[model samples]
Target: MVAFAVEHRPEFSALRARLDEARRRATVAQRSLIPAPTLYFGARGERAVIDPREVRPNAAGQVESLGSDHRSILLAADVSLALPVFDRAQAARARADVDALTVQENLSIEARRVRAEVGAARASVAATRSSYERWRAIGGAVEEATVLARRGYESGQVGIIDSVIILERIARGRIAQNRSRAEYWRARTALGRAVGVIQ
Candidate 1:
């Protein structure tokens, strides 16, 4: 059991890293849209003053030295300089789009990786299964030979040593077939898990 080492698979690790980075970028892009409050101030008019010459009316009602007709007034105003709040909704929608795309891309990559891993695992399982089947066939033939050899020895037609050798070889083939079968089943399980479609 060489630890299987599936956890350290490089392709899976790279996919996870890419997903995390996409999420982080989407988050940053979304947070950049909040508007900060701002204030705008400016002088609007000139100061007004009383005119002494306009205090007295003209004696002839037609002669006036000076008249105060156009006057200036000092005006101060404060206004909150805010971008139209409703416009922010559009930016928010864009942010949502970015986030959505990020999620979609990550899921897409994940699905692809899962499918690829499952395919590879399934291939391994198939090969191992074929080996197991081949070994099983060989084991059966060897077992039959061992049986014949044992009967021959009992009947004094063969030596005990040949019987023992045949039995050992048959056992060895059986062991090999058992090992292959075990590996095939283990690979099947791995492929199921990778595909997220356990059977």
Candidate 2:
């Protein structure tokens, strides 16, 4: 029953999910401490016109000629990484760790609560069933006495008042028995709820 409750209870399942999410966050934070490299790819095309007549004279009086028109295509690839010099995700990791621990503790507390409820429900069902059985036995005995009283009254051995009294006792016994039966069913329903068998 405890296992069923833990598996089926919505609140418990939510707590478990929270714990899992916390653990996942913690793992991500821990991995963030390592610097991840980013790859970049770029391509460029250039078309330019250079006049040959545009010559220049150097300091040594030598003539320098400008190249002709040309087209160039450049493709580059590079990888960049940011060093973890200042922030290593320490604070985030710490927070995730704390959250995971808190959720774990809460899950444990919930499990204990479920077990306690199931135990109490089982005990209640047992007690109520015993009470109902006892009442049923009393009711049976009262019914037998009522039959005897009716027979005596018919034979003129028992007075009408006495027979009426016996009938009233039978009625009271039946009422008590019915009440006990209702209590037993109620306890069973409670047990079902505790075990997560009922909504």
Candidate with the greatest lDDT versus the true structure: 2
Mark the 10 consecutive residues where model 2 has the least summed lDDT: 75-84
- State, as a TM-score between 0 and 1, how close model 2 is to the true structure: 0.64
Instruction: Tell me, by TM-score, which candidate is best.
Output: 2
Estimate the overall C-alpha local distance difference test score of candidate 1: 0.67
Where model 2 places Cα greater than 4 Å from the true spot, the runs are 33-85, 137-158
- Tens digit per residue, CA lDDT, model 1, 6-52: 34445445655665665665566556665655668666777546566
Give stretches of model 1 more than 4 Å off.
1-82, 85-95
Q: Model 1, residue 4: displacement in angstroms?
A: 25
Among residues 3 or more apart in sequence or in different chains, the pairs in candidate 1 whose N, CA or C atoms overlap within 3 Å are none
List, residue by residue over 66-102, the lDDT tens digit for candidate 2: 6655656554445555544545687788899999999
Candidate 1's error at 193, in angstroms? 1.9
For residue 100, model 1's alpha carbon misses the true position, in angstroms, by: 1.0
